[model samples]
Target chain A: MAAPVRNHVWVGTETGILKGINLVKKQAANYTDVSSVTRDQEVNAMCWGDPQESEILMGCKDGTVKVYSAEKSKFTEFHDCRGGEGVFRGLGVVDNAIITCVESGLLKVWQEGASDSLELQVGAGVQKMRHCDAHRQKVGTGGKENDLKIWDLQKPEEPIFRAKNLRNDWLDLRVPVWIRDLDFIPDSDKIVTCTSYHQIRVYDPSSPQRRPVLEAMYGEDPLTALSITPDGRSVVVGNSHGNIAVIDLRKGSVLCTLKGCAGSPRSIQCHKSMPLVASCGLDRFLRVHHLNDKELLHKVYLKSRLNSLLLTSRDKWEEEERVAPVDQDVKDEEDEVWDGMETVEEKTATKRQAVTREPDADGVVKVPSSKKQKKKKKVA
Target chain B: MPHIIYSAWGSTCPAARPPGSVNNSCKYSDAPAEGHGAPGPSLEQDVLLPPTFSVSEIKNKQRHHYMFLKLKQDRRREKLALKKKRKKERVALGDKAPPKPVPKTIENQREHDETTETDEFAPYFNKQTTPKILITTSDRPRGRTVKFTEQLSSIIPNSQVYYRRGLALKKIIPQCIARDFTDLIVLNEDRKVPNGLILSHLPDGPTAHFKMSNVRLRKEMKRKGKDPTEHQPEVILNNFTTRLGHSIGRMFASLVPHEPQFTGRQVATFHNQWDYIFFRFHRYLFKSEKRVGIQELGPRFTLKLRSLQKGTFDSKYGEYEWVHKRHEMDTSRRKFHL
Candidate 1:
């Protein structure tokens, strides 16, 4: 197995295979034993276990959370949380405790070496649950007919904020509520969400109004996944038709649409600081696109339908290039030879500078000599 | 000045030859080369002819028709002479002639798809399970669709046809799973014509939706064979090279019984060309050591895949493995998905 530091993206597939992709090397490797895996163990959600990203916690379809250690390149632990009725929708970690939410809306917090776990029922038909990066204890839950609700882990009895449904439409019929995915905007109290009805909405919990402050529509198909940009001014949303568009959060307008995806995207995640976004889905290909130019940078066929993806927060890609090559001493020796040759060029350059300065000094002396001769002629 | 006149004359030579002689354009092109090689009488003729001359520019229709007929007759004579020369050359080198070159086709020059490994059909290929298929149609299917399903059920072994009765597929899936059916097929109709097909593998699925067209019933065929037997038929899958193509081929393979009964001498073929799946059924007979014959068992149709979903029959919420986006995917004529 290659070093986990070299892999920039980790994808969970429907065939119960975990794939690690290195964009710089243009190689993808399956991290799981394909022969031993069954369809019942399909990976549904994944998240970094720690701030250093050395551990990954994957939630599977059979109500098991498996922890993969990047340093060891293998799975180190598995915890069976089987009270939920459906597959897990989200996974998170806070202070060495694991947070898991399932489709049937069973949210649980399991502490290390503890027999009893803190469980909460957010609602039924939960589509997604996302942890807020700005606050450790904050998490949001939403789904079909289930409005957005932010829960504080410390106070599990009541939600901190509950989003109200939109007003009746022009036909006087009730508007439907189906939140497919959501992410909390860093440095603010705003939570942005994409709905199954192709609507992107941002709600301000700090404001008195419980309704969404902004709403925008992209395409006609249902929006399946979304991720906030690093700057948090825009959000990237992918629909069921394999169309991904970056929409502005402030003015509620589309910025640009990313192309080259053939099937519906299951998961999309933007890089922490780079102008790049990685998405994988039913097409079985992991594609990385530049958010600024929307150019497809890398595409890797992982040979299975991808369910979720996790992009490494590491920003130093060139550092991995220097560490990847095994022949370090050979490179150092080559550098020494080049360094020795550079001094010879420096010596010739100094000699040429000295020769050029002597001519400038002679020209200065000749001008004064000519002036003196002209002065002598005027005196005569 | 001569170069300019030469180019103008070269452009006008083909149009000046005749109408309905497009295939003889190669022979006419050689005329300019012969003129350049032997420039005695041909040069004088070229100088006399107008540069912008064309048969369409003729003012009189009768004279134009007469010239066209004469040119056609002359080209036919030249073609016959060339064929005679080629036949004589072949006869001279009868035993030592080089093999004829093979023709190129879109299938032979197809772009390589990277995903061709076989993985998903292990259970079916391992002979662990027998095929039990349930064929149904869209709610309230009309004349042609009813007949088509009846013929399809007769062709496939251990299959039964049921009326939809307007039940939701999501509801029907659970009942079908409890009954231990291996596959579920639903035929869709539009304006009393069977136009769509949805094939979903049972228990765990990778459902495929196809656009169905050109359905011909047994009675409609000109000289079809008699009604098929109850015995299992041999299956033939052709040109399924790509990864998606392999998946589709496996799906079709699982539709029939694993063990073929050769005593029946019946075959069902699914041939893929230009991404369209052509299905044919036939009955074969061995006449002698070197002689064989085949009769068509009718109810043949063509299918083009529209979308393949990961799970069973949940179009609204299920994820698609591949979807045919006409404007985006069909940009190239040579590129094929299946």
Candidate 2:
């Protein structure tokens, strides 16, 4: 298996910059998009291109799918998947095909060696297309005023599951539909969705009830992003107001709020094994929050407004600490050498002034013995 | 004789003087050749002495004074009788003291008192009508600071962001207020990390300064593996850690958007160095048992602050509007800014 990817949060920014943030090291490494020499393209969406999670499939605003290789530390391939109407909303890699979904709801599957891509219509106004790694063949699609539908890639005909709107409100008013973000619960047929109306709803397709099995509300601002906690019993959701809260699915109540995020949070992802959730947003900040106690672990400023981020499982900084002793000694020696150079410059300047002053003394300056004797007599 | 006496009294009373005689005399005087002798009193004399009475020259002064006293006594008696009658009527009606003239200020004070009394009991009632806020961090904030700023913004209703690195709190306060921002939060950073925060409420302000330490995020905490289904119990926030903290918390709580949009599923969260104040709200839900239940969800966290200061922000002493006051009070009068 490809060496387990190092533990880092990969972030895509609006300015087409990709950043790998080392949480343990508390540092961010930036990579510029070299595809266009003229102007930078907006990185709209990104997904792991291969099962090894070494290649990042980047969906650009300009209808291009560029695969950035983490091993090579550069973009390896570029494919043009022309969006007919709106910009790309989602991007993913299913086996050898690059799956891309645009805002206009055109889902295209591009084969690795093929010039032309296979197309499928996912209805109109698709906001997000989510691929479930647990069930590799399933992808979820939803948007504003659109029903949340899950589709099987193997059979592109009908949706495996589609969420039904809850019964009419008390006054018989039709509830408006606005699905912001959703995630499929691992090992279950349940899907948890956070809405723009500040709601968290969990729908179980296995059950006969069309309405959500559990629904809870978080903050006063519409929830823009959400991620299932490592335990899968809770979900961490962020709103347009930049508030992040962990809501318990069973009780439908907020467990705690993880504070210290400003600006609207765009995306949130919880690590599968660690009690950590990484979030990024318009504030251009990548924040890692501990799940159980709601404490912020590490914060990296990426400089540009971050739209989405992915976190790896392994910790790279932990390995660096094991090999830091020799590197520290070398760095210390270099530091001393740099310090010695500053002292050398000062010593040379003093000598040059002494040499100039000696010329003014003329013939008397040639008698160094008499000059030193005179100076000693004056001191006495 | 009665009619003659009445006419004599009318002529003597200057206020009751007939207009015809004055006009006739004026007309005759204008034709001086024909009417040099046609006046009872010359117009010139009338002009000089004006026929108006001085207080001392009035013949009915004593009588007028006596009549005034009599009328005053009668009015007093009538008023007393009316008051007694009203009192009797009120007693018959089983009413309390008569209504007094309540000034607008007193009315406002009483109205405020009633609302506050209600708020003391049911703080969750109608919480949506709070002011919208705008939260920003001090210039060149680190990632953690921006995240904190966003967290603050999310906890308040209708709040938006104005992100300019290293923005002066004084400059942004007025601009945010002009934009209808009810509150302005400025996260102050030291050595590129947030260590202080200033919550300046817009328009009228009691800008709160809090020294932040042990700055921790959720990720920094060790997992306790607490019961997932234990539903974090409801906290009774009737009393706060400090009086000032209570007011600040109330002030922050009062900024939630009124008439919450159920479809949008909004939430408000407030967190400082110590405590986390959360306002989780779901719109109307209809069920059989409760019929209609509105869930106001949030869990409280501890918050700590150095001091609670009021008034506008200023560069000197790092406070505004209170510059003159601070200068008068401070003996050293040194300039300080954050």
Q: Which stretches of candidate 2 lie over 4 Å from their true place?
A: A1-7, A33-40, A315-317, A320-380, B1-338
lDDT of 2 by residue, B1-338 (tens): 33333233333343333345443234323344333355576766555432333233435767546544544665587678778998887787775657746767754575323213222213334443346677777767778767656544544445676777666777777777677766676767788566776666666665656655455443343432221121212222333454334556665555554454444433334443223332232223467775874443322223344334344454222211111123322345342211
Q: A270-379, model 1: which lDDT tens digit per residue? A: 98867789999988889998888788878898878899999998653533243322343354465454354455435433433433433221111111224433543454
Please give the DockQ score of every candidate, comma-separated: 0.17, 0.01
Q: Where does candidate 1 chain B have its weakest 10-residue lDDT segment?
A: B1-10
Best by DockQ: 1
Q: TM-score for chain A of every candidate model? A: 0.84, 0.80
User: lDDT scores for all predictions?
Assistant: 0.84, 0.63
* Per-residue accuracy of model 2 over A229-323 as CA lDDT, tens digit each: 87688889887656788899999998898887755677899977667788998656789877866777777777666877887753222422233
List fnat, each candidate.
Answer: 0.41, 0.00
- For model 1, state the Cα shift of residue B78 in Å: 91
Question: Going through the candidates in order, what is the number of backbone clashes in each?
Answer: 0, 58
Off by over 4 Å in 1: A1-4, A80-82, A170-173, A323-380, B1-129, B139-142, B164-175, B178-180
Could you give candidate 1's per-residue lDDT for residues B47-150 as a string of tens digits?
64444554456567886676566557767987887789888888899988777668899976887543334355567876777889999999999999999999
